[model samples]
Target chain A: IPVLALGIGSPTWAVEAAHERGSLIVSLVGAPAHAESAIRAGADLLVAQGTDAGGHTGPIGTFSLVPQVVDVAAGRPVLAAGGVATGRHLAAALALGAEGVWMGTAFLASVDARPSGSVLDKLLAAGPGDTVVSRSDSGKTLRMLRSAWSDEWEAPEAPTPLSMPYQDILIGDLLGQILRHEVAPLVHEAAGQGVAHLTAQEPVAEIMGRLVREADQVLADLGTTRSASPASIRPAT
Target chain B: IPVLALGIGSPTWAVEAAHERGSLIVSLVGAPAHAESAIRAGADLLVAQGTDAGGHTGPIGTFSLVPQVVDVAAGRPVLAAGGVATGRHLAAALALGAEGVWMGTAFLASVDARPSGSVLDKLLAAGPGDTVVSRSDSGKTLRMLRSAWSDEWEAPEAPTPLSMPYQDILIGDLLGQILRHEVAPLVHEAAGQGVAHLTAQEPVAEIMGRLVREADQVLADLGTTRSASPASIRPAT
Candidate 1:
């Protein structure tokens, strides 16, 4: 059975469920307190997230939070997530003592990722400063390409974004219209600042290979050796 | 003699006057047509700015405009300005055929730099996704941290920023108040996302050295032997 990790859930209940199913417990969207509780409840691994990470992110940055989580995990392996897009970034994460890296935005630009052409184009054209973290669009402080919608919400005269579920419901139909090209002007592409580094659309394997090679070279030059073998570096678990 | 490159001046007479004083004609903010005219008027170097840069920037991005400006400069050296902060960024600029990188935001965080403490703190806490390009703050598409001021202006209910000198005048007192710590809460801290990389206060020389070292390592690993010599890789002229 596939062991899925869900964040922001009750650690005790999650651990009980995992034990009942004979599955592993992994936590997401967890705080330091939650991580401690998850460990107490028998989590197999801990994933520490930083704000630079796209999608759902916690308050801490990967650089600051990852090391803390690793220390907290004791002997258990810790996974580093959030903004592990570039090879250099991954190299930095490894330098921070993460057992492995978990990437989400890096996969978003892959040819198989299935985003729209315009969206992909916008991603390619974006720079590091072209993204914003706001609850305005998705109710979560998601990293997305800066857009007219975000711009409106970020403006002073505009009303603050609605809370979760309500905000999602309010923008849901507008998002549909945007995706259909009915609201072309309102369809703002969403991605992390790493979009600047994504110059082309290629397969996930190719991108992964490139990232590994680059990261390996960086690590070797930095004189840092990884515990895992070269082949094992890829899909680092 | 200090040379102030003026590219945005509309009056052709001013350009001639500056040229008469042996002032190297540098365009401030203008279109390609004005750039071509400045070149025709015996301007020494063309400083091509992209919209990604802080302070005064044109509409185009550095990645797109720098190469074009290099072409325009012909044999003359071209300096790239705007959004360049790190050694990796400098390497990218050189790879784009720029002779040197003209930086602004990179220096804004230095110990000698004059930004307010709270402003600096806000910048340090920000992530790469925390900035926005808005004319609402300064009537130009300058990159700044997303704050209540810009948000208000960007809101559909808010009025547009005043034009140019008028905007500058209107915001001058507010900016002064922010600088003095009297109204810091009311003003949005204007800084590029590069501010996130800075963790502590350091001298400019120290920061520059770190950037140079990191950039050198990156370039060396990339197998670009041309940048191996520190002397050859001098700061932008």
Candidate 2:
């Protein structure tokens, strides 16, 4: 096994069981207290998810969450996630004290991603502001495309969305119909704000190569302190 | 002036005028398109302000926003802001293609901060989840502490807060009274999610020294790729 890990927001009975079973537990934390608790619960790793992330995310941003989790983790590895799409994000994550990065948005633009039909077209063209976190489904925050359906659901006159299974069931048929008809404006997509960087639909290998090269360049730049000082800011003779 | 730059979100009438005076205008943008416009509007530098910042911020996270801004900035310098409270954050910003970083929350715990009474005590103890973005005044979103006032205003049953001047006037007296009484839970404090990192009150010089030392250490670590080979991930001969 190549280091199997479980991803969870809370440490439950299963987490300790997983630890005992020799599986590494990767606890996801949004708050600093959760980071502490995750470490206390015997997690081998921590993933800090920020508000700008896709699918489900919490109140803080990745820039704020990673450092806090790394501090609480002490020496344990902490992976930075949410809004990481390009190679520069990997470099940024490492600089933030993360051992690695976890990203879901970049692959959506890759040929291998399982997003159906013309979804990649939409994802590739969308800008950074196109995603929003709303309680339109399951009465819980989810980061997805800013569709008309989401906008209507978030409108002042709309009723509060029901919780969990009931809300999922309630919205299922509408989602199906929208996708079935390819109603672009009503479609919901689990894309992070980093979707803004997707320029063309390329292979996973191409993406990986670019990411590694960019990260390497960033490291080289850091070693040299790459900015040139303006003569005005230089010490006067 | 060494470099006369304007800090603003909108393209004010004075921006072009300042450019005419041979000053390097610096505009703050959250979206990539905004970066493009700021450049077209005679800005010589761009500051990417992510949503993790206090006072005013945008929807994207710093990790995602920085590279995007840098890409669109062309030859212009780009600075990253929001949730930058440590040397690690500065390193992260630089890795994301920023020339520098802008910070606010770190100074709140410094001796120079103007917080009265035991406000600094509470700030030092608060975690990453302590701040929230609420539409309390100006009808514009502002990042601040999760106080009773914000909670009450954000509650579902609460009436829509008035806009701008009216809103400020409406909440002014209440805020003044809360400050006068030092009602800890009701006082609105502008702090970013990075408040979790604040541990003690120190001098500005001390903070700067530690930040420089930590940044140097981070750069050195990057040059070396500081990570031990895991036994589990070792290649079998």
Per-residue lDDT for B1-237 in model 1, tens only? Answer: 436567355356765676677665555432344456766665666676655556555444454455556656676656766556666555545544456667666776678886677777766676545667777656766677777767777886777788776787887777777668635445565565355556676778997897777656655554432233422111111
Query: DockQ of every model listed?
Result: 0.04, 0.51
Best by DockQ: 2
lDDT of 2 by residue, A1-237 (tens): 424344435455766676566666777776677888777677777788777688777878898889888888887878899988777788889889998888788888788776666687778778888998887865678888888888999897898888876888998888888888888878778878888878888888898898888888888778778344532221111
Interface RMSD of each: 18.3, 6.1
Summarize candidate 1's per-residue lDDT along A73-141 as a digit string, tens digits: 786767777656656566555544456677777777788897787677777777655667788776867
Clashing pairs in 2: none
lDDT of 2 by residue, B1-237 (tens): 435545445475667666566666667787898888777666767889888887666788877788889989875778888898888998899898888877788888789886776578678877777888877854567788777888999887998878766887888787788888998878767788777778988888898888878877888788777344532322111
